[model samples]
Target: MQMLDGDVVLILGGGSGLGLGVARHFISEGASVAIFEVSQTKLDALKAELGPDVLLFKGDVTSVDDLTACRQAIVDRWGRLTSLVGSQGIFDGQVPLRDVPVERVSSLFDELFHVNVLGYLLACRVFLDLLEASDGSVVLTSSVAAYAADGGGLMYTASKGAVLSAVRQLAIEFAPRVRVNGVAPGAIADSQLQGPKALGLDGVKQSDIPKEAMQEGFKRLALMPTLPTPLDYAPVYAFLASRHNKVVTGQTVLLEQGSLNRHMLSSAGVSGGIGTPLG
Candidate 1:
């Protein structure tokens, strides 16, 4: 239906993983897409895959100057931006607080928060005026970790929780002009999600985890029989970024396939009664 037709959308970390999925969805819906990514390799890859129609900007999400330059470039090309998507983040490899060395904790926290939380804040700040002018929306990539434990370790969980809070507060603060929302997806099987350099997991990707372990993890945590692919969750971002979503603001949609329902059932019997009616 081309819900985002004639819109100019800016996405942070849009070169790969969930961000790339969202960018593809936006483009399919007829929006002009701009991506800000730190990896030149990913940028080149996306340019090749998505074709020259998509604007690819090489920049670190944590850097204000980089974000500003990207925003400026978008303005110069597209004249105005209609939506901002913050999808940049780092995972913590589910390392428990006790397992982390005390000496590395400080650096680990800073590195994770800078990319996951502060990066979103900086993107919103840099694009505030443009968003307000366009009466646009902001969609931040949160996670199941934001609301529950075991989705990640202390560092990742806390950072995403902060993202949830920021979505609400920013929605209120930008009310009647710009809308703010978030999507909290769980256990995406194909994500290029990585961990903090401080914890020596900078090169880790979700696909690197053993298939059986990943499947078992999702089975234990989610009521759904299988985990979702990154593409499965992209539509939510596109909907939130659309101008037709006029009344939804300050809400983070949970895309975890009923993972929260796991708390009510025993792990051994989880999903056994999925199709049964509640009596």
Candidate 2:
């Protein structure tokens, strides 16, 4: 459809996982992308895979100076930005509030909020003018946790909640100039946010689950009964970013195959709550 042709997008955390998946999809659909991320190795990999068409910027979303530089670089390259996708976050070492030490709670919350919420705001702040120039859209990568209680600990949950609110508020504030929206992904495989032990188990262990258990668990949560990949979630972001979805601002699109609507997760009649989606 050439819906996004001639547009330029800035994707924070575009080095891997869902962000990388969306980046590839955007390039395929004929849009330029500026990837703002911290991982040099991932950036190098993306450069190898995508070549000169992709712009690579090494910046931490939590750093205002870095984010500002990224915005300026984008403007210098494309003159304006048509889309902004904030996909930066972490799932490391977040435990329940009750189990957390009082002294450590503040720092934990600070780190998560700094990266997930503040980082997004800073990026939007620096690039609002550029986005507005093109009447662009911003799509934040929120989680099912934002709407439900089953995802992360207090901090991560709170961070996601704030992310959800940010999308709505940005949409309202930016108005007709720039559309703001979000996508809440569910139960994606090969996610990067594993807990402190390298496997990073908030609840489910990716490597421990057998293939049969994996499929059944997905069936129990997703009404559509299909295993979805990071790539599966790309189309929604593309739609939200494209001119096709002109009126979709302030909405959080669900990409969980209907898992968010189910009341109970009964994999073999087990009474465990629905498993949280990773990545």
Candidate 3:
């Protein structure tokens, strides 16, 4: 049987991008999946694509009522939830802190935090009981930005860092019952992630970067030399969400494809690994 067999998962932001990809993979692994998405368009499209197998709900993750209603729906249908995969987030357009107008700082921070950070928190909160009851898990999406610099601009980095921290704390709180962990992916290929509305960049997508150009950039700097698709990441999330993940909790797995494995000066081929075979 597949690892996720007999599991029931609720994916926040599962209408498109990474969430959507994970939902599909989970289903193929024999798990029943439901997705909470804010986009009616994505949800409608999913109804046609995912058919009757996956439950689709339209709601913002930042709102308690929205999440509570979705939690009820999951309970009504699946009877229990095995895991919650948080894949909802927005980028900050990589705008430097100094460049951002002082007047918009508060708005920008609130908007980013509300979705990227609070959304994850609210989902975990609303589903806490189900997860505990089922001995389930929580797998969240963080980013390499949380550990190192330049993964995103100031606001985005801070938000993802917050996610990393939450995974640690929530894991402790939910210990011996539900596992809480996270994945910090880098340069997701074909990602549809957009920018923050407060920065007037909500329409801007990371895919706007030319695919070949982006791939080339990753190849040059990353040890893996290949940008990872959501599919590439599905197994990690699957394993962590599954009951098989007994030893891990309160940990955010750094999934940067060995890009950060080298010293800071190594990306330019300045030579940092092994150090000439250590003399």
Candidate 4:
């Protein structure tokens, strides 16, 4: 039997990027998925493409009304929900701490926290009853930014860090009924960058992110020397959202290429300086 047969998963930001990839995988594994996307056009396109089997809702994660309505809609359709994966994220232009204006950084932080932190909390609060009924799982998509400053700016990193902490506490609070965990993924090729005509997103100038420069950035920063694809991390999410992951609650699973942790060890002035290893 398929691992996720007869399961119902509700994914936030599911119309594009890693969320879309994970949703597709769940469907393939015999699971039904409900996608909460902020874009009506993308939601419509996804529905038209994926058909009636996949539920697509146009909603913003930061709005409680939208999230509540979406959850109710899912319950109305599916009768029950077994899993939830929060994959919503926002970037604050990736500027350095010094270069970014204080107000700009503060606004970005607030926005990021509202979407990434509070959004997850709202979703979990609304769905916890249903998840408890099924004794199911909730998977949060954090990023390597939680542990490393390289993935994004300060706002993104701090928000992700909050996510990690929330996972631990939520797991403890929801124990024996529902499991909570998080995934911290490294750099991946987001489909959103395919073209200017893709998603109608704003604030990102097309000329600023040339293909060659992107490649150079990845090569210089990524530990594996190659950017990962969203599909590459899909199974990890699927496994975490399954019954088999019951014992893995409160864990922050890192899908990074082991580079972030390695960097700390390479740094000097820690425990007898550079020559000694932790062992």
Candidate 5:
């Protein structure tokens, strides 16, 4: 049997990037898939392309009402949800704290934290009962930023650090019933990760950069030689969200290509950092 056969999984913010990749990978692994995406464009396209086989829901991850309603819909259709993978996040424009106008700091903090941190908490709360019943899993996305500097700006790093902590706390609180874990990835190829509206960078995306520049820059720092795509990171998310993950909870698996492991810095002194999105 397939590893995920019979599992009912939800990929929150699955419209694009790592979430989309996980949703598609889970399906191939034989699990039934449902995705919650805020983008209307993604919802329409996914529904048409993935067909009746994959359930698609439209909702913002930070909205309690949206998540609650989606929860009910999942129960109504599949009767149970075995896993939830939180894959929604926004970048902080990699702005230095001093460079950010003092006024924008509060708005920037709220914007990034609400989506990157609170969204995952709300999803876990909304779906706790179902997950407990099934002895399922909760996998949240963190970034290499949480551990090392230069992975993102101050706000983005703080938000991801909160997510990493939440994984540990939720694992303990949820107890033996539901497993909670996290994945901290390095620069993802083809990432659609965008910047915060508070900084007026919502229109900016990592994909807006030249792909060759992004890849080569990332390759220079990464020990793994090549940058990884969303699909390249999906299998780890899949295993964490599956029944096979019995012994792994409360810990975050760092798949950062050993980029940050270098003790020796270039003459540039970490100035050669890549600005691409880290999952």
Candidate 6:
């Protein structure tokens, strides 16, 4: 039997990139999926690609009304909600504090926090009742930036850190009724991750970054040489959202490809199987 059979899932920002990938994975696992996205164009594209098995709605993550309406639509169609996935986020182009213009600082901070931090909070809040009724789970999309520097700029990093904190707190508060967890992926290649309009980066996407440049950066920092795709990280969210996973909660799984520990050990020098210890 499929892992998520009979499950009803709601994914915010599920039109493209990791969100889109998660939606597809859930559907394949026998879950009925509903997506809340701000882009009509992306929603239309996803509808055409995934067919009617996937429900699509257009809404901004920052709007409580949009979230409420989306939830109602899901309940009206699916009868109940079994899981909630928060996958909406924006990047900061790794613009350091020194480079950030003072004039743009406040707006940039607000824009990124609204989508990255506030968006997750609002999603959880709006879905609380449905999730409680079903004893469902929440899987939030965090980033390597949540725990490390250089993963993103100041604003982006701070916002993701807040996500980690929320996962822990919410887990404690909602215990025995709902599970809250997170997945922190790192340096995805060809991601549709966008940036803040306040910084004139709304049109900019991670896919626009040169592949060679991203590879070089990853090679220098990551112990694992392979750069992951959004599809590669989808199953983690699927596992977390599954009803079978009852023990794990209040945790943020690090999907950083060993980048977190690269500082202490070098994968570059190691080759072949484990050899005799050197004296």
Which candidate gets the maximum lDDT versus the true structure? 5
The sequence of per-residue lDDT tens digits that candidate 4 reaches over residues 1-279 is: 888998999999888888888888899888999999998988888977899988889898888899889878988899899999998776555566797656565566677788879999999998899999999999998888888876776767788899999999999999989989999987776434221111222446323456576667666545775666777888999999998775799998998775654655434435656555686
Report residue 137 deviation for candidate 6 (angstroms): 0.3
- Candidate 1 ranges beyond 4 A from true positions: 263-279
Model 3: worst 10 consecutive residues (lDDT sum): 267-276
TM-score of each: 0.93, 0.87, 0.94, 0.86, 0.93, 0.93
Model 3 lDDT vs. the true structure?
Answer: 0.90
**Candidate with the larger lDDT of 1 and 4:** 1
Residue 270 CA displacement from its true place in model 5, Å: 18
RMSD values, in order shown = 3.4, 6.8, 2.4, 4.9, 6.6, 3.0
Candidate 5 per-residue C-alpha lDDT over 73-106 given as tens digits, one digit per residue, 9 for 90 to 100: 9998999999999999999878999999999899
Question: Between candidates 3 and 6, which one is better according to lDDT?
Answer: 3
Candidate number with the higher lDDT (1 or 3): 3
lDDT of 1 by residue, 3-46 (tens): 89999999999888889888888899999999999999999878
Where model 3 places Cα greater than 4 Å from the true spot, the runs are: 263-279
List runs of model 2 lying over 4 Å from the truth: 92-94, 194-214, 263-279
Query: Over all chains combined, what TM-score does candidate 2 have?
Result: 0.87
- Candidate 5: give its CA RMSD in angstroms: 6.6
Which parts of model 4 are misplaced by more than 4 Å? 191-201, 205-208, 217-223, 261-279
Residue 21 displacement (Å), model 4: 0.6
* Candidate 6 ranges beyond 4 A from true positions: 263-279
lDDT of 3 at 119: 95
Alpha-carbon lDDT of model 6: 0.90
lDDT for 244 (candidate 3):
88
Candidate 5 C-alpha error for residue 260, in Å: 1.9
